[model samples]
Target: MTTVYAAASMSLDGYVSGPAEAGFDQLFDWYGNGDVEVTTADPALTMRLREPSAQVFRQLLQETGALVVGRKTFDLTDGWGGRHPIGCPVVVLTHQVPEGWPRPDAPFTFVTDGIEPAVATARQLAGDRLVGVSGGSIARQCLDAELLDEIRIDLVPVLLGGGTPFFDHLRTAPVVLDGPSPVIEGDRVTHLRYRVRR
Candidate 1:
């Protein structure tokens, strides 16, 4: 069976970016310790600390067979350079399809019907592998539909005073989670894995 999940870098205040923050670079700088460019740090030391998480991230990319995202995220990322970063099929849930989208032999599938169909198509493409759902709106839709199986959040220590949040407009009752307590803490971030209890 394929498992569907969402993973993202979030701040202490639960915002993914600051208001009017362009491109969310600050929210995602922890991925490569890119902010270190402005601070004093040995290149070798920085790579040493970042290597472990980078390896794990690569493994996840290898395991993902398909990705699902909302139209907003698709537009924000410019459609991942016309190929998904995971190198798998990408299903976009949107009200209107792009003019030049679904190009010949492209890895994208635009679904305007609804979220359920979009996720279903991703599951079919994923097979026994993992289906990655991203963007706050799409993930929240999955949560509401009870289609998500796990949530992997990289809790960054930064405090984005205001901006888009990780979870917004969710109406479902509290969902139970089963995983190791305390989560896995790294140098600059904490990795949390939670299995969604149905």
Candidate 2:
């Protein structure tokens, strides 16, 4: 079965990014803090991760066939230079498609309807592989819509008092999760996975 999951590297204070879109170095330190090299679809970007984190990262890259992200994230990364590091098709949820987009060469689908439609498009693209939902707002929407199957967090030991949160503005309160089942400890981060209990 294909799984729809939300994953992000967050600080101890629950921030995915610090004030003014800063602190990514601290939040994503695990990606380059180790000696193991992992290359992505983008030849220019490669991750040097610890053994444990490398294993988890490899699995995510292999399993995720498509990703759903918000317009904010899409703009922030400049559409990931037209090719996301994961090397998968991307579904961008927005009210309007960005200018000069829907390009024939890009494997990106702009869904203006809503998160549900964006996720549905990603599901079709993913086939039997996993559908990854990114960005705090998008994840919250998926949780509220009951479309998320799992949550994975790379918890970094840092205190970013104010920044972007991995989970926020959830309409449904007290959402229960099953387990952080198989916790994998890495150099400066702990990889936690939980099943969203419906």
Candidate 3:
């Protein structure tokens, strides 16, 4: 079965990014704060994570087959240099395909219709593996559409006062979630998984 999950490394105050795209160093410090090394699909970007975080990251990479992200995230990463670190196909939800995209040899798909179609496309690409929805807006849309199965939070201990939240402006408030089961404690972060209760 393919699970639709939204994952992010969020601050204790519930922000994925700080104001004006600042505070990334505080938000993503855990990615390189340890000695355990984990290489991604991109040869140039390798992560040095704590042992526990390394295991969690490896499992995520193995399980996730495709991703659905908002255009802002796509643009912010500069298309991840044409290859996302996850080494999987990416579906970009946007009003228009960005300029100079749809390049050959790039495992990127632009979905202009909406979040549902974008996720459907990702599921097709994912087969029986997991479909990961990224970016706050996209994740919120998935949640509102009842398409998300789980939420994975790499909870970092920091408060960014204000910024982009991991979850916000839900069409349906008070959405219940199951346990933060299999909680893994890592250096400066805690990996928590919550199943969306139907």
Candidate 4:
């Protein structure tokens, strides 16, 4: 069976990105600085290590064998940098397939509007491998479409008063937690894994 997983970093106040997704945007300028700690606790992490929580969860996402993203993120990512935090099939959900976006050498296809369509495309592309949902709007679309099988959130400690949020301005049904597992990475961040029940 094909499984869909959505992973995100949320804050203590339930804001994943912040006003218009600013928290994540703030990270774009992280400048590989090891001094700024982005996690629940101010832990130690060198440039050698990205976000500990992201590293661990990215490993899981790699298992997906395929990934889907929205055009905003894809275009921002230089036409979706190859395979993401890992090298997996990536399908960008967009109406416009811009030229000269510096696409990765790897296989990166484009899907039209909607998350299910993207998931369907990924499933067809993945064959028997798992599918990953990475990005804000795409994830929300998945949730709205009820196509996501699971969601893993790594609650970070950073505080961004405003930005794009993971779960915002969407009407979602009741969801329960599978459980909580803790992961500590080189004193950088502590990741709490939660199984999101559909």
Candidate 5:
């Protein structure tokens, strides 16, 4: 079955990004800086800690056929460098499409209607692969609508007192998380996976 999931590297305080912070690059430094530390002298244990997490990320980027993002996120990041890092079709939700935005034939699809329509378009484009919900507001909409299946949160140790939160303005009755299984844990960060019970 096709799944819709949201994945992001977040701070311990639950913010994805903040005005004080530079950008996502600073928040998600663990990916490039080898900030993930395994506490074993054995090379096998170290590889064990790293390999599965790497595989999961590899699969996420390759298997996700479509993505969804919020308008503010789009504008803030400049459409993710004109092409999403996931290398898939991206559905951007906004009230009005930007004037100089890329055409429909481009990698991005600006959806003005609503989140439902944007998700539907992404689902159709995804086919058998997964539909990835990105950006805090966009993901929150999916979660509020009970449309998200899974959530992968990479918890960075930094504390940003104020910023763009990972979960805010949600109107759902106490959603229970299934498993906060440690996908990856280290000195700098920890990646946890949870199933959203419908």
Candidate 6:
């Protein structure tokens, strides 16, 4: 079986976005370690924060065989405008395609149905490399369906108090958890890699 990796930079308090999904840009900038420090929370989780290094990120991107994301995450990414990263197959999960929505001419496709179908399709497209689960709910659903293989969390050092969470209303009874190897980038962020407990 191929690996399914999730790369994220969540707050210290466990929030993925700020109120109304406002801080996501700042968060990604932090993820890319772009020209911003984005969050201002306690640096206690420094050891778990993921640092930005295009080489490192691209190395992981090279490992990405396909992309999976929820409607919300897909919309947000589309709003950012430009090209999708990874340059692999992108499977977007949505109930209905948005009106006037401009799908990327690249290999991106929308899945209005469910995950298993998407997974099977992505698997066929993935070949030998791994597939990546991009959105929070997508990750949650994958975990719920026992489809995810590994989770690489970029635990940034910030506490936005509340926003979107990585794992919401999730029951951890099925899967197991493993290794939190550290991938420290700067003095600020650290990337923690975990193997799904199965």
Q: What's the lDDT for all of these models?
A: 0.78, 0.94, 0.94, 0.65, 0.78, 0.69
After superposition on all CA atoms, how large is the RMSD of candidate 5?
Answer: 6.6
What CA RMSD would candidate 1 show?
5.4
Give per-residue CA lDDT, model 1, range 1-198, as digits (tens): 689998888888887767886436655665666232221112233332365466556667678989999998888878877766567889999999988888886789999998899999999988888999998889889999999998888888888788888888888958777883437666577778888899
Q: Model 3: residues >4 Å from true position, as ranges? A: none
Worst 10 residues of 4 by lDDT: 38-47
* Tens digits of lDDT, candidate 2, 53-139: 999999999999999999999998999988999999999999999999988988999999998889999999999999999999999
Candidate 2 displacement at residue 170 in angstroms? 0.9
Q: Report the Cα lDDT for residue 146, model 3.
A: 94
Write the residue-wise lDDT of candidate 6 on 57-168 in tens digits: 6567578787777878767656334245456777777898666555545566667779887777787778899888877788888888888888887676777778888878
Candidate 2, overall lDDT? 0.94
| Candidate 6 Cα outliers beyond 4 Å, as residue runs | 29-52, 79-82, 99-104
Q: Candidate 2: count the clashes.
A: 0
RMSD of each: 5.4, 0.8, 0.8, 6.0, 6.6, 6.8
Give TM per candidate.
Answer: 0.86, 0.98, 0.98, 0.73, 0.83, 0.79
Which has the higher TM-score value, candidate number 1 or candidate number 5? 1
How many clashes does the backbone of model 1 have? 0
Spell out the clash pairs found in candidate 3.
none
Worst 10 residues of 2 by lDDT: 164-173
What TM-score does model 3 achieve against the real structure? Answer: 0.98
Candidate 5 achieves a global lDDT of 0.78
Each candidate's number of clashing pairs is 0, 0, 0, 13, 0, 6
Query: How would you encode candidate 5's per-residue C-alpha lDDT over 1-198 as one tens digit per residue?
Result: 679999888888888886665457657666555434433222323322254455555667678999988898788778766666667888899999998786654688889998889999999989999999988888889998878999989888887778888888888957788998656664456878899987
